[model samples]
Target chain A: MSATAPRPNGAPPGAVAAARRYGEVVAPYLVLAAVWQLAALAFPSYLFPPLDAVLARFFAIVTSAKQFTDVLATLWRILAGLAGAFLIGGVIAFVMAQSRTMDRFLAPILTFFQGIPALSWVVFAIIWIHGIELRIFVIMVMTTLPAFTFQILGALRAISKDLFEMVLSFRPTRWGRFRVMVLPSILPDILTAWKVNLGNASRVVVVAELVGATGGIGYELLQQQQLFDMTGALAWTLQLVFFVLLVQRLLAWIETHAFRYRAASEHSL
Target chain B: MTAGPGRLEEPVVRFDRVTKLFERPGEGTFRAVDDLSLEIHAGTRVALLGKTGCGKSTMFNMIAGLLDPTEGTVTVNGRDPFREFDSFRGKLAVVFQNDRLLPWRTAIGNVEIGLEMLGLAPQERHDMAQRWLTQLGLGGHENDYPHALSGGMRQRVSIARAFATNAGLLLCDEPFSALDEITGQRLREEFVSLVREKRKTAVFITHSINEAFQIGDRIVVLKRPARIAYDVKISPDLDAAEKEAIRARILDELSA
Candidate 1:
């Protein structure tokens, strides 16, 4: 019962444990950085820039107003597209879960869409859509919708029948069943879906921008390549990698807090 | 019998010729409960003794309003529980074999779930859940999640959840069989005292003869297909030897 009892002084056991877990996570990245620096020393500046040079260029891009706008613009497109996919795909997934007939009808279509690559969608969007922003947004949604829908559907199906029976024994109203049972049960799955789609959204947006857009980091990367500014191109690529990692870390933090109950309960055992 | 206040003379639960059929893939229908008939009066505690797959759970589900009888009827408080399902809202609660506590919710949060479904105000529900957890010797662990607690502690939270609803009837399906003998015995004692204090009518299913004798004022043994093998009323004044004799008789019926 005193599994969670705090010590008389200093940090709680839970906090200390979390800190150690985070340290384990960061340790690999440090090793990767060391390897990258070693590899950079063996290569010429034109082909492979040193880590410090890339970092310096990354800082310059981040500090400049015009380049920063490009970064923000790409981030906005990815987020807006993700939001739309989540809303539309969530409803579709819910409908599919509730009715067998609907699920049967829609399963094939979603499967087909899932099989189609992000590059194909970007190509299709370029040919069909007029505006660069709209094209990029459409491509991101196209690439992410099926994944989100299917992942959410899988989560819905995985819910325990025992939990459902326990809730039904209470004789809750329809809304009450959804609020008290359905929603909470699927929340962890929803976070997982978001984590997956976050990577997908960022990847597809960059591809779309690289192929069709006049603005954003992808566009800047193409411009740098055409001007033979490999250093600038490498810098933008490094910035892109950092952005992805930052977003992933932020999401991981959210996931940790959101499912902290799971960690707490599991550790107590 | 130590009946609670305002105990009614009429039965609170009555199963008349109830039968349940389940369809197995590639096989024909299987009869889980076959023409079962029983009556449990208000404020009385009954233990249903049955082996695995003897349809104890099927019967328990019928009483809880989760399944309909393939034949005959099941009535709770004089209403058909399946047909009048909503009418039984807040009237009954169940403690399952496993704790079945929501892993996401804290111990007190799990306890307050029924109250939430009953539309009790958040503050009131929180306070009531806290009091119940305290009563169950889990005061400081209210904020802990189900995973954090031991199996016994989780089961206690589950019992508290059922009791906090203040339901007129409690249905327990081998609620303590998972625990060790000592913890199960301790919890059973705590549970029986709480049920007596609340004056709630309870039907508990157990395979153990000792558990039935320990918990029930009346014991109904069920054979496969769910017909009653033995129906006996237990007297509180029975001596240890008399209790042993009853246990032997129930064991014979169970084995037979």
Candidate 2:
């Protein structure tokens, strides 16, 4: 057949076409069901709760006002932390790019902070601010700064010396260079760093809250665990995972649409 | 002072006994430039022909003030370029072989960058940018990004950008080296017309002997550890056939 020739419905009809496609799609689920059945046969009830029990727990968490409130509180804290981190870390990264002395001075300190786990900072943050909000500040400073600095520095280094000469020849002012050259050229690296740090920040937020929060998803998980209800703890953990996945999907959408022009600009550079 | 502008018009660019050296591992020094001297008059187009690492780029860099000569002084438009970098930068534009258009900017955006550097008003910079883009036959491609354009088109944008700056000296280091023969030839013709119209003095470096013959008003050939081996001035009146003959003759002399 000619490559250009169009098929009638974009795919060939077959004996399979007469069958229900939805049932065909669920064939994989049938295999999964058989595996679950075998597991139920082999394993004890406590270790492996039936899929129905897990589904029931999922529905309960979704319908619970307290669970939803707890999740909202955690989400709010994460958003506040991310906002603060984006601004503070972005400025510091820019400063690092401009001056070698500043970069040298801060490099070791940042590396040291990044090497330590989020849990290590929780005690100090509580001592300093004595509240849940303090963890957001600590998380922003620790998780975001190092990634942001490294991303900006990496982008700066990846630029061609010849391209800089071309800029010099054009004689752009400091502002012009920033707007026309620096912002666009280093955008992809900066975005990648932001995405990486977003995940880092989210994970750290949970750790910080779980260790010390009074009223958030982590706090709820802690309370449930203290009450000896493993199902509630697992449900909260699943919710956190779902939230992270949702944010990632949202970021992907923004990158593809909202920031696409900036991405396009960087692609050529 | 009256005699031929008393070296005032003596030469727009001059290299006075310039020497450039680099150090090698377990070696004292590598002499890239050796007390080389030459004079190029205002509006003169000089082509420096040499093999790779023969110091053609180094010499050009010295003239462009990208590097200082190890020993002798170099001057452009009667000013020592190193003394005031900004002043020198104001009048000198370099076109590298890699058409380094700021990838972030559109074609006209790249062209207008010099005006922004000079602190020109936005309207005037935009107007000048538009005019130059049109002049270089890039009228339709002004808004196109560098990635969206072909190599020859990007080179054309580079040319437009270099010319738009109104620099007295244009230092081109194999600007067309990346292009195929046909595009290179067309660009050379376009370049000749553009330079003639702008009345800009230029020093072009190229490995292609034929390209030097086609675009140059004068040519300087260099051997390794370079000194100018031959200086030839072509008659401006020469037709294409005669220019081709001149190229063949110059190649034969260089090979010998």
Candidate 3:
């Protein structure tokens, strides 16, 4: 819901404001599409296919089960990796936040992960696990650790000592402190971190599938490229981009509502 | 219900030779608060006046149990406040300079947080928040975000939040310093009336002599480094003319 009101328990008062915000966002897409169509007319058809061709390919991918299955596979791998990362990386980040020694120990490891390319992990995965799922796992370990650890660390650091004092002073049960203070304070940052991870993850999935997958959009694209079907390759690439955009839009909706609820609750106080 | 709700006669927070020190790894020690001693009796409204960095906030922080004195102890109702942070919080409500309301929670929710932490039922907490919001001239604006509220209105919300818990000691650190002078005056009057209505003890730390005169039962001025230079009991029954004279005297003391 659009919670534009300042306080929590009170009713909201600004539907007009929300409508304006949506209008501001949707207006730009029309401008972008016009610009893209105009640019397509200038570029060689090989490098930049007509916008209609890309849209047609995107529609076909959306309609087909094969494309859906490939997309789902990539999503599943990312989700599994990220879930594990939150567990492992969250604990590590928390420990690092609490102790200087732990921070010192983990900082270099995280830096190394962020600095290295995801493709390198795919090579290692081939040597170690020698399979597509293993390659996906490698991508997960590489992308998930950096995003999860840094986001969590950033969240922890962003929380004010005043809030900590408030938690400590209230002497709420450990669970209550986490529920009331730590979770709310860190959520926006964690959500932002997830968005960053998704971008990386989509890229990682493409690399993983291109190098090792038996079936997937990236594998399909690689095959088309091998056969010198530039139209099919570009078509597959555009579909993948559209999928990433859809995920981003979904995350945006979730964050806006969640933040509004939180903001309303705070405003009431 | 009768007003001045929890007015009591005994001291609730006692700072006995509370000395707070800070030292960097290679630097000499800096005495933030030096051998500071004070007592806040219930129902008495006192102001701690000092220039910035004169240790007013440090003293309040120690009372709030956010800091531990390097030497001596802070006893809230004969118990070390730092020993049990939760219990200390229960007995004390603080309004910081920055109005440390949770940015995510609304005004009512902010007011109800302590009650929520106390584990009061959610509906009852909502009722209490509503009552306070209305009383603080924020009846219709309960759902307004902090950013949406004017500076003066936000202070009112903060005051309401502190008073809602009915804590024995209310520690306010320059809460109105950021406000315009006229609004600040109105808030001071409102605050004094609120304290009188609630009968709660308060430690209002501010640099404004006008504000000190407006709400303070007792004004304690701190000079540089952290010593209470002047302790004066303001007359509770000063008329407009008498208030002007008192204001002049207080300003003279401040300038000196």
Candidate 4:
């Protein structure tokens, strides 16, 4: 016989462990769905649409070409705004890292921007910017730019001086230094910055759409609100939710592969 | 590249009255090295032995082109290593106190760092790095990340990194100081043999008297603020008595 009793069903220990972990992750969400379904049985369809109706609407929104366009429009706005802010923030962060005067001048201004509310920027964008896409883009950038700049700045500051000096010892060219040392050092923080700003941008874009734009999830939600259709509201909201979840999973996958070199401890934070 | 043409008479490294001072926040100027002058000839192993705050690292930094001398000139290969830093791209290498391996890089990848800077072909660098790794007893560990290796093994990889570049000069700043006694001694022997075989000019900074004796043909003991206190030449033919006298002298200077 084996040293001890074999796993039930003769499954390998690793597979069993993986199955348990996945079950733990799914258990809470299952409970949440059950609770929502129970609430739907008691309340009217307008107040709390049944899960099956919500699922049907969610499928219709995904399957229908015109309806899916709104979802795609929102994603495009979010990505465009994030890409613009990330590029600008990276340049600003680099300048800040290089010069004390630039850092001192720009840091406070960014902090001040961070304090201004997202809705306030939407209002400002409505007043100042004429084009719908430009207005939404400006709002997205304003809301998320500071966080991107600050996070990247923090990462830049946190690079080990010893490691930097070691790479410099080889007398790398400026671009070589960046490709060899600076990029790898800052990448983890950059990914995390994208992860955070992606969420913030998604939320901010919807708000910008509601006020200044015509076609997006937020605009669709406006239509649902006027009609008082709970099913459409939940379904559209889930579409955005699904999109966020998909992107988040993609980011997580990248993190796993990119950071596999990291040593794991038996006890992790 | 060794010493530059017309500067053939000049040593590989010459520091003429170098003084490095730092201004700490709210503490005024703190002098780390004061009016220090030294010369290191090519193809020689010179161990710089000093106390904790005797400016060994300061001098090392100056020679490596990382720091500018405040008062005087530091010339490596007969050029200002700082002002003419880029010109020494593949001429010299440094093995620091810590291994300083790039965590994202494998052992061989870290070894290929200098070769990359030199614009060598990937296959050529890979072969050079692999040979160095294998010579350093890290043959199978070429693909292992720095975190996966032990301290001694990681230090070996760093040694491979410096040597793989085929740099004529190697500056070591207490590379084995953090290792266990046995492992440190073993690496020290391996390092000495490699240095001898390559015929590379080296300046090793350390505080240990035994290490100074083990690695250096000439040991230069330093006092506080970076002035040389004792400089002596040791011969291989010297017996135990001759070696003891030099050791005693180094001890006296260090205690003083």
Candidate 5:
């Protein structure tokens, strides 16, 4: 039986299903906002600003061209770093999957880098790189490379040998084998890695900006904090949250469209 | 077009003194196929009948070039499939025990894979894939993914994939073992008729005596360590009682 059986009442099931799913996602955020508002009622405004005050400041920042530029700058850095990490990390992962020698040589190195925190890299970048943009980019890439590489490697390893054998029986070229078998088999994993590293790279970009960068949301956040502008800090924090959620939603939308062939039960997180 | 009688006289597949050994982590080594030699002519349908772990799949893998024999030579069309893997690029196809359809691809997409490998034009591949899927009774389900199709329909898609390649040799590794009896019978009939009409050389691997009787032009019963225990040619003229007797004899040989 089809998993998405149409409703008996002749309504479009796709619209109804989408609405229900969106409601499920929004419900928790609404509840969390309510809880935050209640907490704001019990605290002083300077220490714990009300939701409305923070939101008002958030809107004010969003409307200002300079403040919006800060948001764009942070986004550009994160996207650039992540795009580089994805390309470099994807090549490394493919090499690791194809060759045992490469896997052995790279496994311990990846593990070592993974053990070093993003903050440590930010400091190292500050010492090593004079340019602020390069420093933030380096820190973001270092933070995300290991996770993307390993996730792609795991996806490569999880491909069934039986399927490979079946494809092999057709005697495809190495490139054909990869296109018809490897790429499709590991696509879900690649998308998952992209989602994970997007979140990670976003956070690391902010952290790197906080340390030494001249411009971005993190820089604005630091400035607001030093001046004891609690509402502004909270508003920037809200912007950060909104940025992360926006990226996640975009990735989710891409995943749903790209992997429409996946069963409903196997929907990605 | 009907396949002319006795058109396939040349030996297309040969196994000479073939042996395979597998090493377990702590269990040393186990012999999967011993020094067994066999030859199958072109356009002949042969069934290698054996139970699980009886080396039927191992033998199939040897011919498919996924595994190399440790002790002997396996040649397809006068060339070693393992060593000269590229030589069989468009000449061989396999229908695995499981459908093995790529979950991310629809029925038509899955069927088009071999054509894609063969470097057919997009329109040509699309037309070929669509025709095969439709011929296999999956006309309207071509857009469905494997998860959306039933077990039987998924197997049909797999069969369509193999046929779409238009390969000269078809290797079936228990292609219908996962389906229910009725579905299996229907697919087996369709598959047999297609194979005969196209005059393709086929090697079907199965553990069922009845399945062998139904589909095999010649049946070879394999004993453990995989030597041939019985080699019998099936004639279309055999009565029901004679067929039953042959099945009983094959079962006895397997049990022995």
Candidate 6:
């Protein structure tokens, strides 16, 4: 009695829709590969290596423990920098949200830090700090801290006064109130802050490594650039890109599960 | 029944010449509550009734330890609720004008908030919340979020939240004012019965005369800036004629 007839392919409607979604995800990457392959056919292999050669290098980097250590090193720097930024930013934001004087005093400083470039932080860290890991960590924290602070402060300010007062009526301990009210109230923005800062951290980590670090993906990319090996360059770049994409998908999945309480409208913004 | 909290000689809540003043941006000082002295005995329901802006909520907040009285003392259980706010950990609870359910928490989770604060074990609090939900006619809605519930159901969840803590003092600031007429009436009846059954010392804030009558045994009508204009007790044994006379007096007090 439905208006549309059954599909000729005999696939369930849900499966068909899922297939279409998967197709949408894969299409752009396929197109990019085709374009790169065409360029490889037209040019010399040094300038534009074919997709197969780039993929071969990608596997080689994945398989060789020494080469793969560079990948792991980069991953660790990105994660550690982001974690450092998030913790420092959370404290600053909490203090700022609690006191208007602190907010006024620190807001301008954070904004000023936000204006400073990642490369400048790399230089400052190299001059001011001692070690490579510490330098990259400082660069990552300085670059990403301001945005996290502002996002968390905004979330804190936007908590419902009614809900706050309701929670207060129970006379919870300071820690209890934070666990019950403050944490959940600010978690959505916290997750979003991480997602936004992840991209920034990844980019900033590479820049820091290019300047100061002797061993991360940026160092490897520098090696590729020096050798003028397009395949190696493409392979290393893909590693970072793939890492970012994987993390973004993981964050999206977390948002879905954590915020499932949100009402789903027929149309989305 | 043996009286534990109800038999205490000291007042459960006492407002000794309390006055609350809020500083407006350009209007200078706005006196929301002024020179009001009141005593709420244990196990008695008191409805502070007035027009909007009469500072009923101000008084409610004072009792709930949310606001400090600008001039005089407001004490609950013989201690200051605001200055010594943490002392009343399991002693007081509130039902606000809106449901105020945490949107991210499920119905049972919201109910378990105060229990969580009181450090009840997970299974104990879970069972307590489940029982409260069942008692409120929301037995199967323990997992529904605020957005998934209707207004009436959400308010019931809030009510369940308030009662689950088993607090001695309950402060409600027009908890039923947002619902439709029929829903409001039903909830009012249920709420009043619950309060009586639990023998809680409750301070209810409301604007409706009928709601005050339904909710409180002792009704205190307030004038502007929250001075008690007329105070009367509605005894259960009163006849219709006597009830009508008291209603007329309340009408006069409210109108005047």
Candidate with the larger TM-score of 2 and 5:
5
Is 2 or 4 the stronger prediction by lDDT?
A: 4
Clashes of each: 2, 2, 27, 0, 0, 0
Window of ten residues with lowest summed lDDT in model 6 chain B: B1-10
Question: Of the candidates shown, which would achieve the greatest DockQ relative to the real structure?
Answer: 4
Error of 1 at A57 (Å): 4.4
lDDT of all predictions, in order shown? 0.89, 0.78, 0.78, 0.93, 0.90, 0.91
B-chain TM-score, candidate 4 = 0.96
Considering only N, C-alpha and C atoms within 3 Å, which residue pairs clash in candidate 1?
Answer: A265-B147, A265-B148
Instruction: Report the poorest 10 consecutive residues by lDDT, candidate 5 chain B.
Output: B1-10
Q: A1-269 in candidate 2: lDDT tens per residue?
A: 68677656666656336445866867877898678667766887455556666557867877889778878888787777777766776777777778899899888887887787777777677677765677656665666677777777779778777777667655456776677677777776777776787778777777778776787777887787788765566677777776877887777776676343343556664
Candidate 6 residue-wise lDDT, B19-128, digit = tens: 99999999999999999999889899999999888898888888888899999999998899999999998889999889999999999999999999999999999999
What does TM-score give for chain A of every model?
A: 0.85, 0.75, 0.80, 0.95, 0.87, 0.95
TM-scores for all predictions: 0.87, 0.76, 0.81, 0.96, 0.88, 0.96
Top model number, lDDT: 4
Which tens-of-lDDT digit does each residue in B80-179 have in candidate 4?
9999999999999999888999999999999999999999999999999999999999999999999899999999999999999999999999999999
Residue-level lDDT tens digits of model 5 in B44-76: 899999878889988998898888998989999
Angstrom error of the Cα, residue B10, model 4: value is 3.3
What tens-digit string does per-residue lDDT give for candidate 4 at A99-159? Answer: 9999999999999999999999999999999999999999999999999999999999998
Write the residue-wise lDDT of candidate 3 on A1-269 in tens digits: 55554644343547656766888988888798788778779987776677788778777877888786876676677677766677788888899999999899889989988887788877777677766776677667676787789889989998998767655545567778888899999988888877888778778877878887887777888898888766678778776777778878988998987788453435565
Order the numbered candidates by DockQ, best leading: 4, 6, 5, 1, 2, 3
Q: Model 4: which docking level applies? A: high
**Share of reference contacts found in each model:** 0.84, 0.42, 0.28, 0.93, 0.88, 0.93
By TM-score, the better pick of 1 and 4 is 4
Please state the Cα-based DockQ of model 6 relative to the true two-chain complex: 0.87
For model 2, what is the alpha-carbon lDDT of residue A84? Answer: 74
User: TM-score: which is higher, 3 or 4?
Assistant: 4
